[model samples]
Target: MFGDDWLWMAVQWSPPYGERAGFDTSTTVMLLVTALVKAAFLWLILRAPLPGPLDRRARALRRLLYLAVAYALVLWYPIGLLPDAVDTASQLALWAAIDVLYLLVIRWRSRVLRAAAAALFAVELAGVADQLLDDLNLRQVHWGEVVGLGWMVGGAAATVLTVVGQWRDGRWSRGTLVAGWASLGVYALVITLNLLAGHLFSGGPAVSVIMDAAGLVTTVWLAATARELPTENSVPDLPPARLRAIRVAVATVTVLPIIAMIHPEQAARLTYTGWSTDCYDRPSFGDLKPAQRDAVFLCVARGMDGGGPPMFPESMSDQAILAYGRALCRAKDRDEQEAILTRAGSARPSWGVNPWDLVYVCPEIIGATHPELLRSAEETQAANDAYIAEENAKCRDPWPRTKGVVQATAKYFLFVDGDPGYLVHDPGDQAAEEEADKLYSGDGLVTVGRNSALVGHIEDVSDLCLTVKAFRTAPPRRTAGWQQVEEVPIVSRTGRLTVPEMGEDEVGAGAPMPNLAIKGKGRYRLRVYVRIDDGGEEQHLVVVFPGASRKKLTLKP
Candidate 1:
């Protein structure tokens, strides 16, 4: 009778504003208030005074209905043991059964009352079978109530017919008259409130408050109407199994309230609020328009250089395009978008910027250009391979540059021989004496800042030259920046070494020996800076240290 469909929606729904979700103090208070109402109603029905003519079934049905309502709200006892699905189903089923019983009770005394109750029950059972399968979703069962309102009204008309029929039969009594009116009136009031709740108070605290008040009022009406029912003298026989089940149910519902209060989360584990009727749509991203460009990162290239044209030797500009490609693609205006692309280019050469993809490659700005550079993948690999081979040729032992030096790589190797370590060796693979071949190697340590600093030993002492192009202490350690001092020449016609040794060396058939030795040990930071002839004017920084630790630092490619 109560909380079957419409009222349950309002009762179970939370206020939209705040502190609605989860088990908390406010929700507990609300739940406890409703449960107390149920318990109070149950006590009133069970112990209230009654006249001595009502059937056993009628009295039992009232008590059963009260029990179902009380236990559903007071969830702490044994009824809490049932799964929420079963609990919900049982509530609906019990109420529907009560409606059927009420129809029976009023059917005899007043045909109008009996017909009205029966019609109400029929309206409830309309989509009940489908609803059970549909999991009690209100949308599925609500349509019947739409039609039921008319049936409910029609039953009211039957009330007049019923009163006339009863009075003519000479069986009219005041109790019967009151029961008839109460039955039809209560159903009509409830149906009307339910319709109003759906149409007017759909969401908010007011809806819940209104529904709760209606439930309380309905309970009060039932209590008043039950008073008009007179009790029978004899109790009907009951099956032992049924009696045991009833006792167990009563015990369970009684115990559940205590546990539910103590452990609310567990009791509510299988419960959920109904879905909202509101709907939300998604946001828009506008559109993407294509533009003309050779580089993959043209959009980002423009952004880096302050709206100017893209330069060469692309650095991290490509990475920028890759990161913001989506947003760039979404740009609508072509010239404005192209301006973004124009600024995307970089002048500083990064590791990934090499080998020539003409699609975006720029030789003049990227240092030096070569004919072998190609945009095709196949051509790039071939060019790199040929370049590697040409470089190895100009190594320690020079090879014929038949391939026009497509590429060249300069490498430094440390040479070792005597304990003095300045001793370089390698004969020209001939008998010594008439002219002994010498080895020249920069690999050995020369503690320059210290007293012992042998720049290097050269085979052709006359061709050897040492000119300090530029010198300064390394960056941060210098504080004020690289402090430039003086440019001093260390090697001349009289080389650093005079006495020479000879032997066959690995680099070539014969190499020069280092006879120049350091005077003593000191902190040395003398390093080599090379300018590759084939790779344009780009300089490579290679720092060599002065100890047996042999630490080498290659600062850039």
Candidate 2:
């Protein structure tokens, strides 16, 4: 009947408020007080001599209805009232109504009461299922989830026992009774573990677990007593005056808190006797329409002074806009500037006027007044773009590489300087010079120096044939398969450059080489295209021509 309030007690902490982390003292006090009231009320119903000659088990079951009304105030305040989520608030209302009905008639053997119990059980099962699935999907488990799972197990067990007893005319089968006792047994074990952990006093999580254990223990006791209730036809007879009193009591506890939850403003006046520090203290946008823009600015200034981030007002003075831009310019880094701008932009409606547009309109003034700032910003953007382009050319692109079957291993490299390994057989003095000719000689699909192309195959795949093609300018980009294109500047002193390898390399002293070379020792542009086919064979194509300056341009990191 208390629903997820038991689970909330298990996790005892409020949602973070800006920089404030931990439970709200007011909320904790409210929980403790309501719990005490529930205990006292239950004690009275069990021990005190009341007007009605109520069955002990039946009265225990009925008391849950009143307890539900009391706890709704405690649950609704933090979960829905504070957030102002209308849908969440509506859901809580629906849940409370169903729970109240279930508790009110759970002792009577009626189809309506059985249906209510089933519905309540369904809700609890659904919640537990969601939590279970969420935990399964999450990569890392948190301590809160562990505690929550423990609570779910206990709650589900109690719900199963209660709902089953209702369906079976308030009598538990032997097996069901065992399961109920087992669930309580587990709850006891968990309580023992919590005590052994030695944090039963102060910490939020520890205290909450102890509190939730107490709640579940109460539920188990109540559910156990409910099992002894007389069948549907044997319900205790109560006087009309007792019924009216019960109704009045439940309504008084339920309605007033609901009204408070609905209109928290009036509720605040009764309870909170302090100055309001909320955003509502400032004039709303509609109220500021007739007022000068200074009013909006001053309101925003006060909000910022309270350690809140700045926000864009509906209307901003040119001076204010300039000040914002200058502040961004003064930021230590681009990330900080973007963060400030993002917060300001997020505060305004999308269809409304943008603050940056106003600043951009007078770029000349910004550039002149903040010369070192704006001009450097442009340079910074250019550098950023250049860095992005350079990063895009990096060969370390991760797989899964654009949908293709791995047929043969093939990779291509562009050497601005001729292949470093061409004439370089390692270490010894005569070693490199002796093998230079054979290595440099245009052999099959391989070449040595002077833009000599050499293709190396994956280990034993040296005989694997690859197709090579070249374009005078540029080819239409390959839409399918993995591809990379980079514009490389070539400074050719002799003007002659070799085309990349296409076919297999025959390791022989003299092999007919392709007579593909651009004739010019001047500055030229080489656009290299490396592509991979579905069969995993690599294709290389270089567009060699005279274009772009040969001067080396170094990009900043």
Candidate 3:
């Protein structure tokens, strides 16, 4: 007898549901119903009279009873009370036991039955291999459904051969063969359709209904076509003691190799993969209904390519981070957008931009608690600043305008650290408050600053302003405006003035600028705007260098 509380936990941990309360309840009910049906089948088989010796019928009856007991023990009882690791081992052991018994039955019959048994074993072995290799990648294994399909196919084939052999010996009736074949054909078609539609057992209620119908039909046909051997031709049956000994021997012989072959490390790896929320996470969009959850799980398992280590921070649960990141991308907030990309990093990056326009655009949209994005942004900004510094050093007079241009370009190109102020404000404010609160409380402010600052900020004042000015450049113009455009000190051979022009061209042929002066040493500022569009709606602030001389300067917006 099982306690109700233990029974609930047992149901919670078992196959087909795995700790989901509603699914556990439904599966519990299903197992109970299946157990009852199997019990009834055994009772009916026992009640049917034996045409040969009592001992032969008794042995057959015991075999059916043993199968029923095994089903009840494994599927209906508290076997899942074991730890998940142990439960999996137990389940495999149970399958081995059943397979051995089935093989034994075939061995007891004849050479033909032995050959059929070998074929069935081969199919089962192939199925197991399929489960381990192909189905692991597909993430679509349903052991119950797979076993059911095999049973329907294998049982039908065996029954057909038996009927044919009997008919050859003049021991079969037309009605029995017709009924068996008819039932098999219908069941096979239904199962085939179910599998094709990706329903199978995982479809829940609808597939359960089909399974019930198939079971009922098969049971009825088997009952109607039940036959017994003649007394004179009956094979000698084993006594209960001998049968039990054989059962023990067969169970040991069959189960030991499988048990030994089981790699705990491999099983642990697979168990973690299947149950961990990393590879499969809930959807952030649409209804959060059960169906949607299932769809998301299936989609993530099947849709995403390159199953590698997760990109999100380990502190955040894989499922939560993935869901939030996906939602953030959809919302398209610039900060959140950058955060997602930063979090994805070089290793995994994104599959591409989300097509759905759900737009989760705030930094807070990343589950608020996950600051991995912020941390990553800080690191990126520091790296970008260093790269820009290194690049600026290569330039002649790398200060003010040149330095600012390099910084701006670096920031835009790298696009990692986010807006400049993002890194400093949060920690700076927190530190200030902590110091103030400690001083006011007479606890003495705890000094917490390192020789090297954690935050990254621009060092040079001119570079800072220049970078700002570059960022504030007007929107792109429709066409080049000659009137508003300033003649550059350097010009192309075609008479067009190009800013920071690399090639040699005379100053007289180029366009010009106003308030243009090259500051001593490493600084320059030109207070002129060049209209680069016909609409004259947009312009560029042209900052010139020493060698640059102008023809004409114009300022326009």
* Highest-scoring model, lDDT: 2
Candidate 1, residue 55: the lDDT equals 66
Sort every candidate by TM-score, greatest first.
3, 1, 2
Model 3 over residues 1-557: C-alpha lDDT tens digits? 65434543343323343333343555455545444444544454444533654355435643553444444434544654654545444434544554454444322346776576557655655455544444235564556876857755775565555445444444334433444565566556565646543411233333443344345434444443333323334324457686677457534533342243333431221121223233344334332433333333334423334656344333343344445545554544556655664664523445333322222223344434444333333464566456655643432221243332212211111113332211101122344334333322221111112100111122211121111122122223222433342222221222111222111321110112111222322222223332223432222233333334333333332
Assess each prediction's global lDDT (C-alpha) against the native. Answer: 0.37, 0.41, 0.37
Q: Write the per-residue lDDT of candidate 2 for residues 1-557, one digit (tens) a residue.
A: 55344535433333322332444554444455445545543443243222344465456554554354334325545555443444344454554544555455455456665565566556554554444445456443454766666555646554665545554553433422433553455455555546533422223343443344245434434433433344433334357687567557634543332232232231111121112323445332222222232334334432344454444443443345445655654556556656766655635223222232223333444455644333334565566456434532432322223321111122232233344221111112243334445554443232333222233322223222222222344344443443454444544444344423323231211112232224334555544344554565444443444555543221210
Q: Model 1 off-target regions past 4 Å?
A: 1-47, 51-54, 69-85, 107-113, 136-204, 226-228, 231-557
Q: Which tens-of-lDDT digit does each residue in 195-269 have in candidate 1?
A: 554433323343344344334434544454455345342223356687567447534533343233332232222
Candidate 2: regions farther than 4 A off: 1-36, 44-164, 167-235, 251-521, 524-557
Model 3 misplacement above 4 A: 1-47, 53-117, 125-170, 174-179, 182-226, 231-482, 485-522, 531-543, 546-557
TM match of model 1 to true structure? 0.27
User: Which of candidates 2 and 3 reaches a greater TM-score?
Assistant: 3
TM-score for candidate 3, please give it.
0.31
When superposed on Cα atoms, how far off is each prediction in RMSD? 24.6, 21.2, 19.3
